[model samples]
Target: MRPVQRPRRSRRVLLSAAAGAAAVTVAVLAPQQAGALATAAVPVAVVDYDSHDATEYAARWVNPYGPLDGVVPQVDPSGAVTLSDVPFKPGTDFSVFDHLKYIGISTQTFTVPKVGTVTFEVDIAASTPGATPGHVVEGVYGPPGAWSLADPDARPYTATVLEGQQAGVVLNMIDFCTGQLFDWFVAGGSAFPLIERLPTSVTGNTSNPGCPGATEVGLDKAYTQIIKNIPLEPGQTHHVAISFSRSAGQSNVAYALDGQVVATVTNVGIPLDQQGNRYAWTGTYPSLGKGEKLADQINSLSIGHGLFSLLDAFPFQYGCSPPTTSPGAGACSPDSAAYSVSLSPAERSFGQGAEGVFSGFRVTTTGR
Candidate 1:
């Protein structure tokens, strides 16, 4: 495939075509403030599910199913996609992922050089209840050296050259289920705060989801202290970008909505001991959201520290296809057809059909 060239854009001008209500602009400023200069954005995945293979995005193969039986996602020719059907009953189970419904975009897992900037940008919108809370968007898969440190295993990316522990980075939309209209949590490593004993109130808290006992505390820490909630136009399609950049001894992540910086999380995790090095990868496989970091690691480039290894161990998938391997819409069974993929008997529908419409996606690395 040819390298997708981003049209040269003038600084101070919108970098991408105006969409929804946003006008995203490229970085432009006085020479002293030029640290934020961005390279041309790369075109990664087409959110519309219609052209599965042609879209340049793929699915991942992983184990450990959510509470609901793990069913493969589904795609429609109209460029729509759907996750496994999950019914909302608060908690019959206390875990965060029990009885869930969602999908991820893997394949062409993206990585950035040890230095510079990489951003995964996409336009997202919920189908049902539309941008309601708890219907949050999250995922950036593993870290470099996921299993061990200094192992040349190429299966996953390393989080840091030191420990090599791995987990996904998730954002909790403020006000679960309702989305509080639109507020999100994006953490920066500068601080570490824990969710103390939470109140049982069903409002402004995660308890409404029926999460109690240990799960409640877990939810609190996950959703709180990491970052502030970014206010967004929940229902309207919005351009969102997750960017990692290091400057002047600081490693920070900026979350942008519709061309404007909404939140910035810095000094994210301490275990990795990133020092001045923080690395990130995007979408290896079996995950959702385009450009969500698939893996990341931190280490010095000037040294000979072989802190991590990576490998494409899992089987590859080029986007989610129609469950039936049939031709088109008619060929594939209706979402209500049977207990196949993308739908479930344990589902409660709020009238959003099928899946989300990700208008566009891309993972771009600048600064080598």
Candidate 2:
């Protein structure tokens, strides 16, 4: 999923007695046979959160054999971290993802190779009644390049200024929570992408994309297929499944939603630096070992969570201004920094809290 470019505020209301709600995820592992269908079987790091109680929701979600290296959930005294009717206000950048913990990733090391697909299914019932847009959003992120090649001191991929030869390839999933709702909520006012995104560098370029970010939340590119106008209702269980698959060096990416191929990207141009060395996922991009982990993770940009992944450790004065129409350089406003820092001490790990355990399972497969 591509990071949400814009986020909007929503109203919140108390629903039922907190206890959270029931949810389950079934991960279909890739088949072991080399020529088998891509969806056949998976072998490790599965995440099962359906049966987790309050305690499990807060902690104890670390799966050694699963794809996640850790899981950091945020809960309250009321119960599990159920979605609030109020808009899901994500933190700026890293805070969006820092609040989460990967299930099996102990270090910055990512085991998933550049190829292969990981497919999983889940049930999301709005814990509240009349669940609407911005209530509960979810998506899978590719194994993000855990370190910044542009700036050595920063953790995660903060070196967002990839002009040319700036660094390695970038990967991470964006929101796939509510297909239609996501499109409307985030891609509204824009030509909107049914499902697909361009690299940051190419976002403002008015070439093949042709369409501009004239409106908030819209994408310039659109795959051949899309699920439009579907609403996410509260208290109703929507069986949702998403598969994340990519080719070597990200030549292409294909995503299937609810068993249907929703988007396919055949040409994602490489963002080059002045040196012209292609910015591709290469050596060390997934080098963080079990003991080594980045300071934070990533979240959808539309809701304003994954901003930190591209920000400097401390807010710096962006020498250049940004375009008013585009989520360009000016996105690094001092106000943005202040807002993100406000969420300081974001949860990097859920060491202690009311506990809940995963009742669901994950199916993870890799080529490396």
Candidate 3:
């Protein structure tokens, strides 16, 4: 006689939801194996309102058994924390500091027990929408030497969740001069070659502030999702994940639509040695003039390993604003809506690892 199989509850719910929405749905059947597959399932962490900083819209959520460290700020020369600087209204928005530098929050310390794909997601918003062009929410992965902002390896790539335009953006709950949003970035190491970028757009809202010349909402209310394939070692692979939404979460607005997929990358290979350590970095560039610093606003970051991991959420200052076609029209102003995440053991860890946690997620909005 043949054995009976049980259906997955979550799968059933997903199917029902798809059917109710009148969306095309496809189902695939998996072949039964003699023993349970030793594949590792990526864990998930969700942060609604409670997990973030009410003031800055930032937080750090952790997974116990996962390999993830804390985030930090990129130091400046004046002994003050640095931020990315772009062009914008004085009290209305923030800015990005430099173009090529890596400025945002990071996820350090991750371990892969098997070879598979790693995915990440987060909800993000901005204060002033549709004001600039050079803004972006990017993700970086792989060893320090293996990654690059200018020319990232084919494995670790970037996606533009939102494209900078002159209209249609959304904001967060707080009514400060600025608001907050969710953004995510993903990269596949040498092992996995799948990459993607997801950004949110202005949906169900019709409000325009900040730039009178702009048309779309001044902010976005949505999430950024990332998926990457990674090759693990024979036993385990130590890896890291990081998220950085620069320019007060206002860059790349063209791609900012509700539940839109911005970029996708695939075809990653296997790693030669996976049983090592992993590290990540996130922060802002600190060398620009006073009016060109962006407030780095990071909400929450997570690292998972076999269902155990760590989270850190905090508020730091970088800068913001929309991209400008004019030479000096939309420069970044200091509005204090940015945050940072700092980690220890600057490099990847090979053995047992530890992480720090910072909790706080909030954003202040100005203007009408």
Candidate number achieving the greatest TM-score relative to the actual structure: 1
The prediction achieving the highest lDDT against the true structure is: 1
TM agreement with the true structure for every prediction: 0.39, 0.32, 0.23
Q: What TM-score does structure 3 among the candidates reach?
A: 0.23
Give, for candidate 2, the lowest lDDT window spanning 10 residues: 14-23
List, residue by residue over 72-175, the lDDT tens digit for candidate 1.
44544544333322222321111123212332323233343433444555444432221133321111122211122223532322221100001111211121
Residue range with the least summed lDDT across 10 consecutive positions in model 1 = 301-310
Candidate 2 residues lying further than 4 Å off, grouped into runs, are 1-51, 60-81, 85-110, 127-235, 250-252, 267-361, 366-368
Ranking by lDDT: 1, 2, 3
Candidate 2 lDDT over 1-368, as tens digits, reads 11111121110110010001100011122223323423454333433333245554424333332322232344444232322111122222232233222222111222333334443333222221112222212111111121111234332222221110110011123322111111111111111112223222223333324333322112122111222333333223332333344333332333332234434333222111111333232121111111111011111111111001111222211111322332211233333222112112222111211111111222333332
Ranking by TM-score: 1, 2, 3
- Give the C-alpha miss distance for residue 366 in model 2, angstroms: 5.3
Residue-level error in angstroms, candidate 3, position 107? 5.7
Between the candidate structures 1 and 2, which one is better when assessed by TM-score?
Answer: 1
Indicate the residue-level lDDT of 269 in model 2: 20
